[model samples]
Target chain A: MAISGGAKGILIFAALALLALALAGFITGAIGAAFVDKFSGDENVVHGWTGDVLPLDQPAVHLAPQYVFGDHAGDSLDYDNKEAKKYDDSSKIFNDNSFVITNTILSSLVTSGVLIFLFVLGTARMSVVPGRLQGLLESLVEGLLGFIESVMGAGKGRGVFPLIATIFLFVAFNAWLALIPIYQSFGVIEDGHLKATFLRPAGTDLNMPLALALISFFFVEILGIRAHGIGYFGEFFRFGNLLRGRILTGLIDVFVGLLEGISHLVRVVSFTFRLFGNMTAGEILLLVSSFLVAFLFSVPFYGLELLVGLIQAVIFAGLTVVFAAIAVAPHEAEEH
Target chain B: MADLGFHWPSLLVFLVNFGILLAVLYYFGYKRILAMLDQRSASIRDSLSEADRVRQESTQAREELEAQLGEARRAGQQVLEEARQAAERYREEEQARARAEAEDFLRRARTQIEQERNQAIEQVREHFADLAITAAERVIDRSLDRDAHRDLIERALSESAEAQRN
Candidate 1:
């Protein structure tokens, strides 16, 4: 059945949300288990390992450092610290060090590297009569640029088009990476239990999302300042009445500035969380659905996951563009 | 278990992850993609403008060619008309010359005929006068009386005069 654009958008959003939740759950579970283990007398509480590693006979309990990775043989790769002690668990891999580098970070790095390489190679070989790869890349870039130009106005849109397009690709690729079987496997257990492994959503990971938000935030302010100079800061301090009769208005301006400042702070948190929550939730949903019904039932959900990844990426990029446009644009002179 | 509360480590992990993601994307993905897009768009604009210029030039050339063709056609027509007029003038002049020559020939023939007629009349008169004198001399040689000769002479004179008058 042909899906409408809105339906497709919703489906994608839902998938991303599910993924975000799943990742968040895994992280929270690990962290919560670690903290609880610190207080509780349970021996497993300190190691913080959960999921399939916990025997079915024993109810899983929260522990300190809820996940562990590497083995005593020192053969395993430890993300947090290469020097961390290793122990031989069922799969010769012990401890969950997935959160140390953060699965989201690793995935983003991989996705970005691949995408940039493709983009550069494609561009280098572009021709009027394009080869297959060149043609595909050109069309994709052109189409995206056209869309941005339409929304942002031709003159300004061209400036931010690349930034927005890149964000879309990065987020989309990372989301797809999360759906891969290897990432979902976490660890293989000899006893027939699967340990939940990586818990990073490239966008949903608070560090990545917050940092992106902050960059956008900083640039927005900077652009505003550049455009308006001293006047841009005046929106915050509002000390225009130091000389004379405008004291009352200055005080009011200060209040307005304060409010604006608060909103800017909120922007950082909100932008970060919005992406993080959506992506984490989507991951969780997909995981639960698959766990309940196995691989066959999860097939349709994978399509949903693909759509969700795309939408989340678009939404993130779109928001960035909007914020950038607003920040850079000179504030209208206050209409008295 | 105590009611679940806010987890600081999770928050820290989230912050750390967000930081790395932003760094990677900003450097590798965003910057590069943006550069590529800008280059692509500029090229497209250049192509469109070039097309517009070529179209304008072609139109101008077509118009110029049409103008030249029109001028050539007008010149040819003018030349053809001048030639026709010259031919007509030449024909009229030839016809006039022929008519004048015919008139001159007719006038000369008429003058020649008049002169020839006058000469023939003079010759005939001389011959008649000579024949009359010979006849008178023969009559005188036959002899007769003075009064009879005088009467005969008067009758001859009167008859000669009458013959001359007829």
Candidate 2:
């Protein structure tokens, strides 16, 4: 709590410097310049160069990741220009093209590499008495396994842990990595504005979340079928009572079964959009904050995005565990 | 859906990427670490049980050693007590034998002294009678019958012996 005179002076000086930088960033940024042009009555002074220099172009939100390399990188540039034109006129139709190496794909590869490298380093010289990195890795694994076991029960939990933990870590790391300043800084620049970056968060891409959703969907259905045999489908198609001459109750059961079947399929769409929407919204929020104030303002949003990433990851993995548990449980045990 | 970037190829790629990651992480990270943990715990349990066994064995051995030492000490005391009693009995028997021999020698010495004193008294009586007869004869200047003197001395000695006997 106590600071020396010299240290106190240095601290005060640092705070003042940061305040000055934030104020300067605001004045030259998009909102502050619009006010300056309006009040100072000088259109030529600040507005001319600031518009060209500050990347003041509205953020282009394409649901797909732009290609940064490979054969489709040239087509990706054309597609970027088309997307940019749509923001100005609102009548242009967007062209969709499949590319070999998109920025999001690159980001996912980087995330995977980092995870593997960390694991290799932690487990290279493992012993009963662990060093710091080994200890950290061990505790992370144990904590994740403990949480999962608490949800799914101990014996069944370990059976599904690898898949659950991988999904959680991958999604969480992808979001966190995008929060780094360099991810948005350098990119393929066209027409004095940014087009595509070398990296983007994998979660932002529609395909990434779609892939995860499909994986989760299949895993859940397969587990159910394996657990209950053909009877798992009986939960969705209940015509058995109608065959036995209970007309009223059979109709109700049949209708409820129909609803259940639709809802089970709807899970895929819900899972996909939930992650993609959150990730895309976060990315856009960061872009808009920087466009509005340019500096010191997006820092808080970065913290918000960090919490969002963790929550989304936990939700994704936790839901999967719950679904798996439901799948494996005896559905008709209570009826008996 | 196309506007949302739903390409089949890209989704397939993502699936493959995830599959590879899962395989590597499961094999390299989770399996080995769990195995090592189980091994460490098992070894620790074995060591603890081994230590308990050694402590019990040492305690039992110490008790046995103490019991043996007590038994030896009691045996030694019993031998020493018997030796002491035997020595006391030998000393009493030797004392009794030495006292009986000394009493027997004292009785034999008393009988020999009585016989020597009686003999000396008889010799002294014979010499005294001879001297008296010689002196009477010298005064009378006549020869006295030797046989008569002798007879007279013998008769007097016989009567003295009879009186001493009575």
Candidate 3:
């Protein structure tokens, strides 16, 4: 709380130096270079000022994760160059040789590994009176279970908790992990540029979200069917009124059922795109901000991305819970 | 769809990855944590009920002890009251017996004194008669009839005794 004059002066000097570095970063960035070029009519202001340093290149975004390591990694495949007869039409992108591990897949494995390691370490020695790690894990698990139970009611929530909680933890951890500085900087560098980063957020890859979406879809539908028996399909097919000699109302019910069916299927797309879009946008925002102004400017956006990660995780898991709750709830069979 | 990066292998890998994670986590984490939580809550409930039972038992025991003490105190007081009454009765009986004995002794002593006084009075009357005869004979100094003197003295004494009695 108390500082001598010299320490205070040093603190002030450090603060000023940090500000000066931030200003220098802004001045050397693309916008500053453009401003200089516009004002002084210098065609290559960036080249003149930074001398050998190239301006930040546009961020390369791949919808499919690049195969950085395992099985045919860095192997350029030319269909025409392959044995003309052996390369069959059925085997387009994937053959025996094409089952390579992508960067996103590797990242997913890492994320899963981290989760496993944490769980193993936390549960190695468990007691009613928990130590720090166990206490933390217990509280986190309890909170997640409580949230699920709040939506699904107490006894039934435990059934779907593992899947829901996993989805949330996977998505959130992937986003947050990718935000680490090393994820951007430490990678296989090729020709003085990054060829592929070893770690990328799995949510940015379409397959990851698609996989999770499909899982959630199956989970909800299966639970619904299990709870209501074969009668669950009756929700999508309304022939009760048709049998009762009410053609007009029956047709309306049919149309509504059709809409309901379509909406249910559409949840998969919505789930996939929502996570993919936000994650991609956050990654781009971070990339662009750091490119535009190197250091201090992107800090706030990083904080925002943290919030975004948590929100997306919650939305994904929370929606699954709500959908599951609705699925198992009793249908209005008495409307007839 | 291809341009948007729909790859089958990646999807399969992700699904498999998630499945394994779920299995491992269920075994190692959620199941144990939930069980521990339930156990803790159960133990707490049991302890609370146990404490309540103990308190009730202690209160009951205290009440019983107090009741026993009161009964003992009451019994002691009753015994003391009975003893005091018995002692009072015994003292009165002793006083009554002593007073009766003393009165009986006084009556017997009064009868004996009355008998002794009668005897002494008889002896004194005998002595006085003898002395009167001696004095009469000395004054006369003349010989008289023994049987007639004896009869006269007896008659005189008898007449005097009768007069005294009247």
Candidate 4:
């Protein structure tokens, strides 16, 4: 019963959170656009040092040379302005700072890769008398598996654990990645002081979650087909029952199928936006809160940001599981 | 609005990142951890079954030993009782034989005494007879008279001859 309740709560909370996050993403994007426009003129001004150009017609430039590189001529020479040009061009393509090799990307890749590796290794060695690492991984997976099985009714949950676990790891790593001071130093020189800038969180970047969501959508349909065969395809058209006596039920089934398809499409959008909004909002909130009190008074909000990061990660993964479960469930089997 | 350009390298990097993550998880986390867990569970089960087998064998051996001991004790008691009975029977038979032998010796001694007594009586009788004969002969010689003395001698000589022949 606890398992069922937890599954239900996770599903419901994840769905609601995803919707809220989508709305928030839209709002933040709009607000951020406005904020950027409002503050565009207040860009920090720095002493730009120019040196010899490479064959690619790129000039070596350095910003706040004392902070990034010590006051050494060799350090200034080492700065590759071509890398900056590449970043500048990529940033233009995304219409945001997403394509740049920002701190968020590095942290996300490192943290997620490390965590997934450890978890998989631990699970591979799973035992009743497991070693410390294996035991921890087993317990975590078992808890999730038990919860999913209880809700989806045993045997029904196993097919989706891999997807769910992947989503969990990805979102968790990305969420935590956003918390680091990745964007705290990103800036463009306009006036005199160093003003901070931000790049989109890894999961918030649409491409990541969209790719995941599309994969989930494809598999869900595939599983339904495999489970029910051509009859599953009949869900979309479903005219045979109409030729028989059950016209109303057939129509209802068709309508429901259409609605389900629409929801599947919306899930991709929602899943992407949800992760994006949560991470972005947390990042923005931390930035703004810290700005309000300089730095000292914003310490407590960092704790809040950490909590939010964890919750958002859990919410994203939980929703992915729920969707995957619904997609693969033998709901059509009941009709038969 | 400034047009943003596409960079292929960043996209490639992203793909690479995803690939690496998937590979690492597949190799390190999934394979190794699951194998370890299976190994641990198997070992635990093996230990438990081994212990159970040993326990059963020990119990069986103890029961067999107890049964053998009980049989040995019963056999020992039987042997002890048999020896005691045999000793008692032998003692009784020897005692009965000794009592019979003692009775036979007493009867023989009685018979011998009777024979001796009879022999002595016979001897005594013979001597008396002889003495009487001698006395009569002496009287007749001394007094020698005629016809009356001759008759007394004849009678005494006949009596003495008869006693000597007996």
Candidate 5:
């Protein structure tokens, strides 16, 4: 019997979601394996910022399908000293770990390379009347620039377009790249363990997301400073103003200022996790769906992932714009 | 949880990569396009403004032309009216001149006719007297003296004049 469109759509969605779940589970495994050492060593190999290490003889939570992680289990047993079992429980965060290359660095370089290639291709022969590729690039850039201007009035918005535009495009492309079937699936099997996913989503890693977030954060703060001299901090630290002014209003000002400062700091974390969580979740959903069903059945979920990827990028870029606008005009914000 | 791992090498690489991307996109792509777009917009605005100015000037020129046309028409009508009045005055002056000349000519002709008529009357009367005297001379045939006859003739003349007067 011929399947209805609805059934096909459902199958596709199910395939994508299952693929995301499976890939997400694999990311967990891969991270788990990163912590596990192949041979015994007296000094604990500092894997990342987290100093905590688990003896990998046995894993606490073996993620969804057990087979993909089975290779690591065998490797750990072969070397008895370093038990190869540790599963990540903490979500993505960025902290200073003395520079050691990770999969994220490789993925990021690849993503940037692709972006650079596209930029060169798009801007190769710039013309007033754009061709197809140029037109598409312009539309995306102009469309995004218009959105930023809308959020932050046209006059003030122009200065911050580079940061917001770059972040949006980079994050969006990274997210979309993750959706490709071979992105997380294709890897070299070394001693029964999958090694080196050739092209991973940069946003999926904590480093890239955090790095992007920091860029946005600093850009917003610096813009604020540049716009409103050193006095810009007066918006945050109102204790002196409180002492000099009416008690009630001053107290309110102080409290509001502190809250604003806290919110400003919180944005870094917010920006980081927002991109990280969104891309990671989409990656997981896609990975799980692909693992669960055929590629043909993952079409609907692929569409959904595309939409999610776009939304995440927009949201990330949008927040940065809003924050920047607010930072520039703090007095206006407080009045409201 | 696997995502929380921060590798500095990766982060540094990411920062540099993105930084390069921003510079490229900003300089080569976004900035260039924006400049072009701005130029296009400025050109459009200039064209629109130029068109507006030309339209305003044309409108003013048309109004001026209409005013001049109306003034010229009024001047033409005035000239025509002046010509008609001048023609009427000239005709009247010529008629008055002709009438005066005709009256003088008529008066002179009437005087001449009166003079001729008076002359003719005197001639006829003198001739009649001559004829009567002659006839009387033939009838009398020297029977009376010259002085006596002359007296008689005078008497006859007086009598005749009396008869004629009566």
Candidate 6:
């Protein structure tokens, strides 16, 4: 009976993989024809994969001035151009960045929602011998915990594991899910152009990265404050206690402290750009690859992006854990 | 990257999304799952340690039982040996006492037999003397008394007893 359990485990895994493969094939079959039929147009309609390029701002339809007075195709084309121009002018007058929600924000919401759903379902019934969802989540949790413990001591790792792991899963899922042939390929046709893609990978957005950076930045600083009280400020503005000490040594200490503070502050920018740039570049690379060499050659690049996506998540989470450890460690504590 | 420039609305949306994610994940899933994992691992470890301790205790008890069995065997042998030795000593003492009593009885019987034999011989010698007297008296028609023969027999008996003593 015990031996049967082992065999059953293998059989289950193989069956699940086969089922997934079959589902993917079925989806590609259903959607591939429609995509080809729609996009297989003349060369003028540039199959912009990234959708970053705005195709030539051409008229949606023919219009004429006479069309306003009488219903006619020629007259409509003449009048439509003026109407379009007037709409553009008014839009320009009131347009502000405040209301301009990027595709990344929507992607981010989708990413978070998916993660929450999976996590909730996975952990709903946690048997000691886990089910499928629990098994997957356990592996992820254990792996992140191991990484955290390896960087920080086991005691300190527990404190920051949740935050780092959350960031990692959110970022990584967005990156990989963004590549699943859905984010950019499908969108509503607007004004004779495929504008306003409904989904974008969260990491592709600068704002998402900035938000993540701010989160990490605040966490690190908070940890420092908790660990050392007001003394953590010494790492930054060391000159506060300056002239009341050893003169030459104090000046060097203050200057070094200032440099350290600057470096610490710059980490927010570094974090933001690093993750945002990597994920965005990865998407662009995949899009370009797909365009250059249809499906066959594109497969390898997809695989490459998968690896890259994983690496980015690991780097992001790993750095967060390490930084938290460094921030929380007391100055007098010897380095492990 | 047409809209790659800064967007204030995007920032707020991202922050809001992240905030919701943090709350949902921490409250609904991660907290419980992590606690369960910790509890399970600790339970497993405790069970393993308990099993090890039980094994150790059983092994120790078995060894003690073996040692006690060996001691019991040795003590049993010692008791058996003591019993055999006591039986042997009792048999030897009984045999020696029996032999001494038998020798004393034999000596007393010999003394009584010698005295009886001497007495019988004296009676036979007196009877023979009386028979001779009677035969002579019958032939000559006279009676004779042989009491002097008894004295002779008594003297011989005393000498024989002194010889036996020497």
Which candidate has the highest lDDT of all?
Answer: 3
lDDT of 4: 0.56
Please give the DockQ score of every candidate, comma-separated.
0.06, 0.27, 0.33, 0.09, 0.20, 0.23
- Tens digits of lDDT, candidate 6, B78-141: 9999999999999999999999899989988998999999998886676656555544444454
lDDT by residue (A203-269, candidate 2, tens digit) is 9988899899988889889989998999999989999998899999999989988988898789889
Off by over 4 Å in 2: A38-55, A70-99, A332-336, B51-166
lDDT of 6 at B12: 66
**Consecutive 10-residue window with the lowest summed lDDT within model 6 chain A:** A61-70
Residues A1-336, candidate 1: write the lDDT tens digits: 999999999999999987776654443353434443442454332233443354222222111112323332112222123334333231222224433333444455566666767766765644555677667766776677777776666766766665567667767877887777776455324334433244344554555566566666776777677768877776667666734568778677778878878887898878877877777677767765554333445668888888988888888777777767666665673333
- What does candidate 3's lDDT look like per residue over A21-140, in tens digits? 898777766665555554243332243255246544445666556667544342222222333543332224354555556778888998899898888899888898999999999998
TM-scores, one per candidate: 0.62, 0.74, 0.78, 0.59, 0.65, 0.68
For model 5, the stretches where C-alpha displacement exceeds 4 angstroms are A1-107, A117-136, A180-196, A241-258, B1-3, B67-75, B78-86, B97-166
Best by DockQ: 3
| Superposed model 6: Cα runs more than 4 Å off | A1-43, A46-101, A191-193, A240-242, A245-254, A332-336, B1-3, B63-86, B93-166
User: Relative to the true structure, how large is the alpha-carbon lDDT of every model?
Assistant: 0.60, 0.78, 0.80, 0.56, 0.69, 0.69
Better of 1 and 5 by lDDT: 5
Q: Docking quality tier of candidate 3?
A: acceptable
lDDT of 4 by residue, A1-336 (tens): 356877999999999986775544433332323433432332321111110110011112221111121122122111334345422333232423233453334545666666876776666645566678777776666676676676567767666666566666667766665566654455432233332233335554434555555655666677778877866665566567667879798778678778756776787778756765666566656655543323334557778877777786677667766655655567654454
The weakest ten consecutive residues by lDDT in model 1 chain B span B1-10
Instruction: Give the B-chain TM-score of model 3.
Output: 0.55
Give the higher-lDDT candidate: 3 or 6.
Answer: 3
TM-score (0 to 1) of chain B, per candidate?
A: 0.58, 0.51, 0.55, 0.54, 0.58, 0.56
lDDT per residue, candidate 1, B1-166, as tens digits? 0111112344455445445555555555445555655666688999999999999999999999999999999999999999999998998898888888887888788777777776755654564454357446756677667777676666665665566566
